[model samples]
Target: MFLTVTLNAALDITYRVPRLRAHSTHRVQEVDERPGGKGVNVARVLAALGKDVTVTGFAGGATGAALRNLLAADQRERPNHARLTDAFVPISGTTRRTVAVVDASSGDTTQLNEPGPAISPAEWQAFTTAYAGLLPRTTAVALCGSLPPGVPVGAYAELVRAARAADVPVLLDTSGEALRRGIAARPDLVKPNGDELAQLTGVTVPLRAARDARRRGAAAVVASLGAEGLLAATADGAWRAAPPQTIAGNPTGAGDSAVAGLLSGLADGLDWPARLSRAVALSAATVAAPAAGEFDPSTYAAVLDRVEVAPQPHAA
Candidate 1:
């Protein structure tokens, strides 16, 4: 089974408004709520693609309960035989919530995120134990999103180590210090956006940045260049994958979809080129979807065949 870790799970709310202006009161045309966080988003995409996936992290309080209920409801609503397990560890503090304000006029998304609850020492220990216990069952594990308060920046590093110990590949997706520490653990793969890549490697050139990141101990570095494409540098080789054309929609969770594609492809034993093709196509499909963590299958199918995967020269 594919496993995803969201240290700070959240109840995500998406608000669609005709337009958003500063200090202007406007009525929201639509409202949608569900469980979210980078890992949960990835799991949603995996489940949609008919992959066996489980999401684990910490959840507490009323919002946490509500999120779990929503997850169970989502699982029940699926017609496919794919399974999605909710394995979140219970905590004492209330889980946080995030809001995505989508401006219908321009399709721009404004995100308001809340920092997750502070984890106590005992709660942290419980999460580690739970994570280690799940490692053996995971074919691959994705460590995603920002660390909750009271959790160390090196948490993902430790999680990566545990997964490695269990002989499971790990996909690390986070930014800033957490990412820096996690890369040192030499995760199987690391996906960072252009800005994060620049911050990590101090290079704006995608290929050079990816190479630098790989040298820092990540087995591979996949840099998400928004509408440009995805640049992947791995031991097998390097390649840049992009869709035939970029479609416009809500791009809120596109990165998570890309992560899902790469992980599912890896679990399926796809090569670097084919894996990147799937990742790029899934990312485009997610951009065309109505909400975060959802992708249009029609778009995915159409783009999958059209994705361009060009080999890139290895930088010395």
Candidate 2:
């Protein structure tokens, strides 16, 4: 089973408005609430792809309860072959919420995120202990998202080492210092967007920056370039993957879906080109969906074959 860790799980609420404008009132068209947080989003995408995913994270208070309830409902709606198990640990502090306002006119999204609840030392210990127990049975683990209050700055780094010790493939998806530290632990793969990659490597160019990131110690690095698609640096080779056409929709969980595609590809022993194609297609498909953690299957199937994967000249 795939194991996903989301230390700061959230209740994702999305608002659809005719158009989002500052200092103006507009009627809301629709609202969607679901379990979120980066790892949770990845797990949802993986489970939707018929993979067995067990999600572990912190959940507490009323908001936490609601998130768990919605997570359960989502599981029930999945196909019979799909498995999504929640193994969230209880915390004293209330869980956080994230708001995504989508402009139906322009199809742009504005996000408002809350800092997660503070986790106590005891709670942190409980989580690590539980994480250790789960590692033995896990096929692969993804440590995702931001570090909430009271969690260590090097949290993902620690988890990456543990996964490595257990000989399980690990994929890290985070930003800033957490990402810097995690990369040093030498994860199997890391998915960072353009901005995050630039910040990590101090290079604005995607290819140069991705190569620099790989030097810092990731086995492979895939930099998500939004509309430009993905730039990847791996031991075998470097390649650029892009969709046939740009898709417009809610781009909220597109990155997370890309992570799912990469993780699923790793587990299936696919080659770099095949994996990059899947990642690009999944990310584009997520953009066609109305909400985070959801993808339009038809979009995914239609775009899969059309994705372009071209090799790049390796750095001398």
Candidate 3:
């Protein structure tokens, strides 16, 4: 089974409007809610792709309960496909909620995030215990997203070490100091968007930035370049994968979908080129979807074969 760790699970709420303006009232055209966090999003996508995945993290309070209920509902709704297990450790503090307002006219999203509830010392210990138990049984693991309040800054680094100690291939997707530390733990892979790459490596060039990130200790690095697609640097080689054209929709979960594709490909034993293709295709499909943590099936199928994976000239 694939394992995903979302230390700060959230109830994701999305709102759609015809257009967004400053200090103006507008009618909401649609609202969608689901269980979300970087890892939770990755797990949902992985499960949709027929992978049995388990999610472990903190959940509590009404929002947390709602996230769990929604997760269960999703599992029930898709019985014939892969399964998703909610192994979240209960906590005293309430889980957080994130709001995404989609502007239909521009196809852009405005995100409003809340700092998750502060995790106490006991809660932190409990989560670590649970994470350790899940590692041995996992096929591959993904450690994702922000650290909730009161959690140590080196949490991902610690988790990466644990996963490595258990002989599991691990992928990390985060930003800032957490990522800086986690990469040093030598995860099998790291997926960072363009902004995160720039922040981590201080280089705007995708290829150079990815290479620099790899030297920081990730076994491989995949940098998401939005419409330019994914630039991957691995020991085997380096490649750039891109969709045929720009896809328009909500791009909130595109990065997570890429993570899902990469993790699933790794579990399936795919090579770097094929894995990059899948990751790029899934990311484009997700941009065509209406909400976070989902991909447009038709788009995914249509674009999967067309994704271009070209080897870089100087991979070393």
Candidate 4:
């Protein structure tokens, strides 16, 4: 089973509007609410792909309760996708929420996110204790999303070390200091977007940045370059995977879907080229889905072969 960790879980809210303006009143045509956060989003995509996945993190208050309810609802609605289990740590504070405003006219999406609640020392201990118990069962663990207010910046590093000690493959999919420290822990894989890669390694080029990140103790680095596709650097080799064409929709959780693809492929022992093809195809299909963390099934099957995986110019 794959495990996804989200320290700051959230209720994802997506709003559909005719058009978005800088400062104007507009009525939203529709709204979608789902359990979200980086790890939760990754788990959602993994489950949709028929992977047995468990999501663990912080959840509390009414929002947290509602999020769990929605997760249960998802299991009931799609039993064949995969089994999604909730193992979140309960906190006294309310979980956070993220808002995505999509302009149907231009097919553009705007996001407004709130910083999650600050966790307590006791809460952290409780989470770590439970996390230790879950490590052995995880084939691969995804340490995803932002660190909550009270959590340490080195939280992901701690988790990575624990997973390493257990000989379990772990993937770090966070940004900022968490990512920097997590990379130092020598995870099996690190998936970062171009900007995050640049920020961590100070390299402007995606390929060079991914290589630099790999040098910083990560076994491999997959840099997500939005529509340009994924640039991956591994011990085996480096490759750039791109979709046939950019499908415009909601790119909200495209990165998460890519993570799902990579983890699933890794579990299946697929080569880097095949793995990246799945990542790029899943990302493009996610863009075609109307909501964040969901992929269009038909779009994914059609785009699978169109994804192009080519070697990086400087890397053999």
Candidate 5:
């Protein structure tokens, strides 16, 4: 089973507008809400793909309750799919909410995110306890998203250690100081977008720079290059995976869906090339969907054959 850890849970709200103009009033055609946060997104995608997944993290206040209710609803909606294991822990602070405004004409998205609630030390302890109890059953642990206020930057590092102690591989996806500290723990995998990769490795946007990041401590690095697809470096070798072409749709949560594909592939004992293919397929499929963090299974299957994986000579 895969264990997904989200430090800051959220209710993601998305609105679709005809065209987004600065300081201009626009009529929204659609508005939707879902349980979100990076790890939760990963779990949701994995569950949709028939993987045994569990989500653990903080939830509090009315927003937290709503997020939990949404997850429960998802479970009920897909009872035949893999079940969510018990790992969600409650805390004192209310969870956060994120908003995305998508321009229908341009397919561009502007996002606003809350910093999330400040977690207490006691709440941290409760989360740690719950994580420890779940590690034994986890085949892989994915630590995702931003850290809440009052949570130390090294929190992901601590979770990495716990997963290590339980003989479980860990994947970390975050940005800024949290990512900087988390990488020091040397998690098995780290997925960062081009900008985040540049920030972490202090290199310009290039494949060589991403490879340098792997040398810095990431056992393997998967850099999401927007429409360019994924650039990956692993102990086995370096490779690039790209879809046939970019698809137009909502781009929100595509990275998280890619994480789910990566973890699911690893759990299924897929080779690096195969894993890359799955990741690329899932990411592109996500972009073809109208909802954030969701992909049509049919679209995913159709794109799987179109994903191209080629070796990088410099990756070694």
Candidate 6:
């Protein structure tokens, strides 16, 4: 089973406004609230793809309860698919809420994320214990998202160590100090967007510079290039997976969907090229959908044939 760890869980709230203008009173046409955090998003995608996935990390307070309830409802709604293993640990603080304002006219989204709850030392201990207990059952672990208050920057690195101890591969996805520290743990895979990749490597070049990041410790690096698709580099070789064309829709969670595709491919024993193709296809499908992280299976299948994967030279 795939295990996903979201250190800072959240209740994601998305609002649709006709035309978003700063400091203007706008009427929201639509609003949606769901369990969120990068790992949770990945798990949802994996589950939708008929994979057995379990999500674990820190959750607490009323918001946390609501998040769990929403997950339970989703599971019940899709009983024929994979199930969520009970692994989430409850803390004393309430989970965070992130707001995304989607402009209807232009389809652009502006995100406002909360700092998340302050985790106590005791809560951290519980979270760690929960994660350790599930390591044996996990075929692969995805450590995602930012570190909450009171959580150290190296928190993901510690989880990577636990996954390594259990002989399970880990996929680390985050940014800033968390990404910097997590890479030091030498995760099996790390997915960062072009901007985040540049931030981590301190180089403005695209795929060429991404290779430099892989040499630092990540066994492989999958850099998301938005409309251009993904650039992946591993010890064996490097490849670029680009979609046939760009589709206009919500771009939110596209990277997370790509991570899910990569993890699903890895769990299924797919080769690097095929994995990159799947990641590209899924991400494109997600962008074609109206909701964030939601992808149409038909669109994904159609895009699969169009994704181009070609080898790239290793940086000297």
Candidate 3: list runs displaced more than 4 Å: 24-29, 104-107
TM-score, candidate number 6: 0.96
Q: Tens-digit lDDT track for model 6 on 292-314? A: 87887888999998898888875
Model 5 TM-score, 2 decimals? 0.95
Q: What TM-scores do the predictions have?
A: 0.97, 0.96, 0.96, 0.96, 0.95, 0.96
Report the lDDT tens digits of candidate 4 across residue range 185-252.
99999999989999999989888889889989999999999999999999988898999987887787
Which residue pairs of candidate 5 clash? none
User: In candidate 1, where is summed lDDT lowest over 10 consecutive residues?
Assistant: 74-83
Residue 140: error of model 3 in Å?
Answer: 0.3
Candidate 1 per-residue lDDT over residues 142-204, each given as its tens digit: 999999999988998899888888999999999999999999999999999999999998999
Q: Quick one: best TM-score, which candidate?
A: 1
By TM-score, the better pick of 4 and 6 is: 6
Candidate 5 positional error at 85, Å: 3.5
185 Cα displacement, candidate 1 (Å): 0.6
C-alpha lDDT values of all predictions: 0.92, 0.92, 0.92, 0.92, 0.89, 0.89
Residues 190-211, model 3: lDDT tens digits: 9999999999999998899999
- Model 5 stretches with alpha carbons more than 4 Å out: 17-29, 104-106
